[model samples]
Target: MTTTTIERQRLSIQTNPVDAEFQQQLDQVFTEDACALLVELTREFRPRLQQLLAERQRKQARFDAGDLPDFLSETKAIRESDWQVAAIPADLQDRRLEITGPVDRKMVINALNADVKVFMADFEDAQSPTWQGVVEGQVNLRDANLGSISYTDPNSGKAYALKENPALLIARVRGLHLWEKHLQVDGEVIPGALMDFALYFIHNLAQRQKMSTGVYFYLPKLQSHQEAKWWDDVFRYTEQKFGVPVGTIRATVLIETLPAVFEMDEILYSLRDHIVALNCGRWDYIFSYIKTLKNHPDRVLPDRQVVTMDKPFLSAYSRLLIKTCHKRGALAMGGMAALIPAKDPEQNKAILAKVTADKELEASNGHDGTWIAHPGLAATAGAVLNKHLGDKPNQLQVLREQDAPVTAADLLAPCEGERTEAGMRTNIRVALQYLAAWISGKGCVPIYGLMEDAATAEISRASIWQWIQHGKKLSNGQLVTKQLFASMLDEEAEVVKGEVGSDAWASQNFERAKSLLLDITTADELVDFLTLPAYDLLP
Candidate 1:
C-alpha cells in the first residue's frame, strides 16, 4: 500500500510479487515458458481489445443520441444463411442443471460435487478479484482438474473433496472491461480475461485432454459479434500456441448485453468453430437494458424484483435466443435461478417452487438446460428439465421455428409493473450491502433469501439511475430526485445497519460502500460498472 511498495511492484511484473507464498506459487504457475506465452497473448490481443472497447463507447454514444439498437444490416446474410456451431463435447451435452459460484477451494469442491451437469467456477461476477484471490483461484482449479483438490475447514474441521462423477467444470473469466492489476506484461497490466483464459487453459489442458473433455469456458458481458470474434481469436490462438486442435477450446457465450441479443446469430457463427451454446444471462441483460437504453423514457424499467424473466421483453429475448441457438445446432442454455435455500421449511419450499417454475418455463420453451445458484435446488431443476429432455441429451431438436416470430419491438417492450417506495428502499439496501461485501473480498453473498452477485446489484443501481433520469414517480406519488434518493439512501443505510447490527457495521466496509453508492447513484452522468471504481480499493 505504500508508495515505495507500489513502485517496486510496478516495475517487477514478471519477477517478484509482494506476498512470499503468492510469489512462490506465481513462479510455478508462470514458469519461464508460460510467462512467454502470456506476454505474446497480451501484446497481440490487447490492441484489438482496446479498439473493441472504443467501438463500444461509440455505439453507446449513438444509443444515447436516441438511436436504438437493432439487428445489424451488415450481418443479414450471416443470420439468414444456413449455419451450425461445432459439435458439443460428450461432457457438455445434457447440461440439465449447472451450479455457479466463486472459485475458493471449498466452493469449488462443493459446486463440482453438486448434483448438476456443470459448475461454472466464476472469476467474473461471482468473485472479488483480489491479487491473492485470482491466483489462489488458479491454484484451486489446477488442483481440481488433476483430482488432487482437498480442503479441511479450519472452523468446522470438515473435509471436502470431489466425488465420483462430479459436474463438469467450466471457468467464467472476467469481463473484457477488467484488467489484472497485480501483474503487468511490459509496462501495462494485462487484460484479466486473457490472463484467466490462458492460465486456466494451459494449466488444465493436459488433464482435460486425458479425459477427452477439452477446455470449456463461459464468456461473459459481450455486446456484439465482433467481441465474440475477439474471444474466438483468443481460443484459436491459444489452441495453436498449446499445439492443440482449433476445437480444443470451447465456449458458451452469455448473451447478457442488449446489443448482444441482436447479434446472436452472428456471434454463434463467429465462434461456431469453438462455441457450443448461448446462455441467457438474465441479470446482466437487465442491467444492460437499463444502461443501454438509459436515455429512452419509453424503455425505463420497473423495480428490480418485478423485472422478472417473465416480462415481455425478457421473455422475448429468451425465446429468440432459444430459436437462434437451436437453429444453429447449439444448446440454448437458460439464465440463473439465484435463490438460496431459506432456513424455514415453508419458506424453503416456496423458494424451490419459484426455481421449479422458472426452469419449467425454460424447458417448455425448448431450452436444453438451466442455471441454479444453490446445490439444494438442483433436484428441482433436474426433475423439471428431465421431463422435457426425456432420453435426449439436449433440446436442440425442439427448434422453435414454429413459434410466433419475435421482432425488435417485442425485445424492447416496456417492462410492466408498479414502482414503489418499498422497492426503492430494497434497491438501496441490496446495492449498499452488496457493495460492502464486494469491497470486503466477496462478490457473491446471500441477502434476503436471494443469492446476490454483481449483476443483481447492477440492475438495482441502473434501474434507480434510469428512474431518476426520467423523473419517475413511485406508486406512493413521490417524485424521484437527487435529494429524494440521497434522503432514502441515508435512511436505508441506517436500516441496513439495524438489520446487520452496529458492531458488524462498524467492522465491515459499509461506510465506504455507502459513500460509493451515494456517489454513483446521484452522479450527473451514469457511471458504467461499479466494479471499475471498486477495483481501485482492492488490496
Candidate 2:
C-alpha cells in the first residue's frame, strides 16, 4: 500500500534473480501493484504463522510426555452443536475422481485434460521449492487458467495442448511449516504458504468468478483447528481487500496430521464459512502417527505396504472422517490410489483391480469421492464411485449412523504385521531415489512403477529413524542398529547409482540427495523435517 511499492513493481523476493524471459512470466502474474499488495499481506500474516508454528512444537513436546491429543474442550460446543458449512457450489459437488501433479506447464496441461473430474495443481509436496520452480509454477497456473497453456517437447517434437473440456482446477499451496526465502518483508522471509496462496488467489479469483467456477484450494498439513482458524482469517482478509463476496473461496483440508484427526469437527467449524470437504491424506497421516508417538515402542508401525486402509488404525480414521463430514453436510474424499498402471498386461490388470477395490470401499462407506495420482487409473476409481453414486452428485445424504464409534485407542491401534530387513531396505532405496529427484527439481517421481511425492519420502525417512530409535527387530531377529543401517544405505546408494546410470548419477543431484538422507536419518536427534535442510541445498 506504499507509494514506492506501487510506483516500482519489481523488488527483491528471490536470492537468485530470473532472466528477462522468466521475469516476463513473473511480471505477467505479479504486476507492480499486485506485488505491493502481496508484500503487505505477507507482513500481516507472517507473524501469525510463526506463533502457530511455535505452538506446534509445544504440542509435540507434550506428546513426548505421553499425552495424547483429544477433542478440544474449548470447542466442544462447536462439535456437538447442529450446524453445517456453507452450501457447496455445483462444480465442486461431484468430485468423483481427481488427478494430482506438479505445476509444470506440460504436466498442468495434461492433468487438466485428464479424464478426472478435478485436477489438484500441486505446489507443495509435488514441487522442488526452488526460486525458478516456484515462480514458473505460478506462471504455468496463470496461463492454464486462461486456457492458453501449451508445450512442445524439444526432444520428441510432441505438442501438448488443453482439451476442449478440461477438469476443474484446484491449487494446493505450501504448508504452514515452510518459508519462501526469496521474498523478504523487513528482512524476514515470507511463509511459502502465503506466497503460493496469495499469488494464485489474487491472479485467478476474478477469472474464476466470471466463469462461475469457485476458486478452490487443498489446505495441507493442518495440525489443529487453531491453524485452520488462521487460514480462515486469511481468506476473510483477502476477500475484504478485493471486495470479493464471502464464501466465494472454498478449501478442502487434508487431515494429514495426528492432532488434526482428533479435531476434525473443530477444524470444520473454524473454516465453516469456506469449508467444502475433508480429504484423507493417508501417507502423511501415517508419517505423523509415527512421529507423534515416536517414544512408544508398541506404536511403531510395520512395513509401509502393510499399513493399508483395511488396517485397524487407518480404517477407524477414514470411517470417522466419513461420519464427521456427512453429519455436517460436507463431502468426504478418500485417499489417493498411488499405484500407476504397468506395461505388462497381468501387472496392469492387478493394479486396476486394486484401485477398484479401494474406491469401492470408500463409496460403500459413504465417501463422496476419491483421488488418483495417474490418469490411467481414473476410470477404474471413477467407475466404482459412479456405480455407488448413480444419478447423484455426492453421498452426503447417505448417513452411516450405524458405524461403530471411534475411540482414541482405536485411532492409535498398533501395527500387527512383521518388520523385516526387506522393509528397511525398501525405505532407504525410496528415500534416496525420491530425494535425488526432488533435489533435481522434480518433486513427483515414479519409482518401481508407483508415483512418489514428498509425503512418501517423509514417511520413508521417518520410518527409518523410528525403527532405529526403538531398536526394532526384524522378522529374522536382526536389530536395526545404526551400523547395520549405514552399511545398507551405502549398498542402496550404489544400487540407485547403477539403476540411474553413471551419467545421471553424476549430474542429477544424487550427491546432495544422498548427503541429506544420511544426515536426516542418522542424526542423534530427529530433524524436524527433511525439507527444511533440503531447501537450503537449492540454488
Candidate 3:
C-alpha cells in the first residue's frame, strides 16, 4: 500500500459537510472507540465478504450455462432436521403492519409516529445514501431512540415529533452487493452493510438498554445460507465486542432472492441463534426471477403489473415459505403494499381495496404480518391481520403444513400473462422517473400512485431487458427489440416530462437518467443493478 493509504487506514474516513446540528451528531456517533471498531471490522471480515460475493458470480455463471438452482443436495440433512430459531422478542411479536421509508429525518419522525407495529428505517433500497442521507440517517435514528427526534418543516412551517407510543423500530441494512463509496480502508471501499450495522448498533446502545429491548434488524437481499451466516457472525461479533449476550441482537431476514427461496431452511438454521422471521420480499424476488432465469427463453415473464402475489409461482412461493417458517418456529412476514393513498376519492377507494385484498391473501395464506409503504395503509392492513390473529400476538400457529400445494415446479413455474405494449411502456416510464429521482438523491419516489424503490425499478428494467433479449413479441404483435425500446423510451420521456411538468423536468436529473436507462435496457449483456452505476452520481 502507498504511504497515504497506509496512513489513512490508521485514520477514519471523514464525512461530508452537513448543517451544524448534524455535524455535532456525527461527532458524537463517530467517537474514537467507534472508529476503532470500524477499522477492526474492515480488516477482519472484508476478505471473507469479497470471497462470498465472488461465489455469487461463480454461481450465476453456472446458471447462465443452463444449470438451475435447486435444493442443495449437500445440505438436505439440515433441511430435514427438526430445529427452530431463537424465541421472538416481545417487542417484535405483532408486526401485522410495518411501514418502511428512507432514513430522512422528517421521514424518521413521521414513520415512528405512524401507529404501525414497526417502523423499519431503511438504509437499503429506500435510502439514496448520499453523504447527507447516510450521516443524517444515523443522527436521526440515535435521536429517535432517545425519544427526542423532531422536525420543523421550512415550507409549511409545520412541526412534527414522535408520539408517546411509537411503533417498534428496526434498521434494515444494505445488501452485500453495495459498497459505501464515501468511506475507504486500505484504499478499498467498505461494505455498506457493515457501515450501517456497526453505526446503528453502537449508537443505539442506549436504546437497547433504556427500552430493555435488544437491537433488532431486518436483513435484506441475502442470496444463500452462507450470506446469512456472515451476518450472524457479524451480529455475534458485535455483541461480544459490546459485552452483550450472544443472542441479544435479533434479526428478520428478507428472502428476496430466488436462490434464497430454496434455502430458507438452511438460512434459518445458520442464523437460528439470532433470527426470528423470514419476509417475502416480493418485488426483489420478481426481479431475481427475471435476472436468474434471463438466459432461459421459455421463462420470460409477462407484464410487471400481472405479477401479483396471487400468481401461481408467487402463491406457491408464499405457501412454501409459510410452511417452512412456521414449521421452523419463525414468523413468515408478507411483502410491501406499495399503493399510495390517491387524492381522487374513487381512485383512493380502489387503491385501498387493492391493498386490503393483498393483505387478505397474505393473512389467509398464514403470513404472520405484512408490510405497507404508506402510513394510511396501516389501518387497512392491520384490521385484516387483526381479524386473522384475533387476540394473538402473531399467527405462528396458523401453519399451512397439511394442505400445502407448493413444489419446486410451482416455485419455478413460468409466469403466465400477456406481454403488452402498455406494460412495456409503463416499465420504461417508471424506471426512467424512479432513476431520475434516485440519482437526484431521493431513493423512494411515488410514481403513478405506487411507491417506487430500487427493487421495483430493477424489476422494471430487467423485465424489459429480458423480453428484448429473447426477442419476445408483445401483445400488440411487435417484437421487442432495442430499437423499439429506444423508441418507446423517447416517447415515455416526453410523457413523463409533460406529466411532471417542465420545471421538474428541467430541474431534475431526467436526461442523465434517460441515458443510463436506455444504455442498460439495450446493452448486449444484462447489468446486475441500476444503483451500482447511479451511485457514481452521488457525492
Predicted candidate 1 versus true structure: per-residue lDDT over 293-370, tens digit per residue: 999999888888988878999999999999999899999999999998888999989988998898889999989999
389-431 in candidate 2: lDDT tens per residue?
9999899987778977898889998978988888888999999
Off by over 4 Å in 1: 2-19
Candidate 1, poorest ten consecutive residues by summed lDDT: 3-12
Candidate 3 Cα errors over 4 Å, as ranges: 1-22
How close to the true structure is residue 486 of candidate 1, measured as C-alpha lDDT?
92
> What TM-score, computed on C-alpha atoms, does each candidate reach?
0.97, 0.97, 0.97
lDDT of 3 by residue, 392-501 (tens): 98888877757755667788999889999999999999999999999899999998889989999999999999998999999889999999999999999999999999
Model 2: which ten-residue window has the lowest total lDDT?
A: 1-10
Model 1: clashing residue pairs?
Answer: none
Top candidate, metric lDDT? 1
**What residue pairs clash in candidate 2, if any at all?**
9-32, 13-182, 13-183
Stretch of 10 with least lDDT, candidate 3: 1-10
Candidate lDDT values, in order: 0.90, 0.88, 0.89
Residue 143 error for model 1, in Å? 0.5
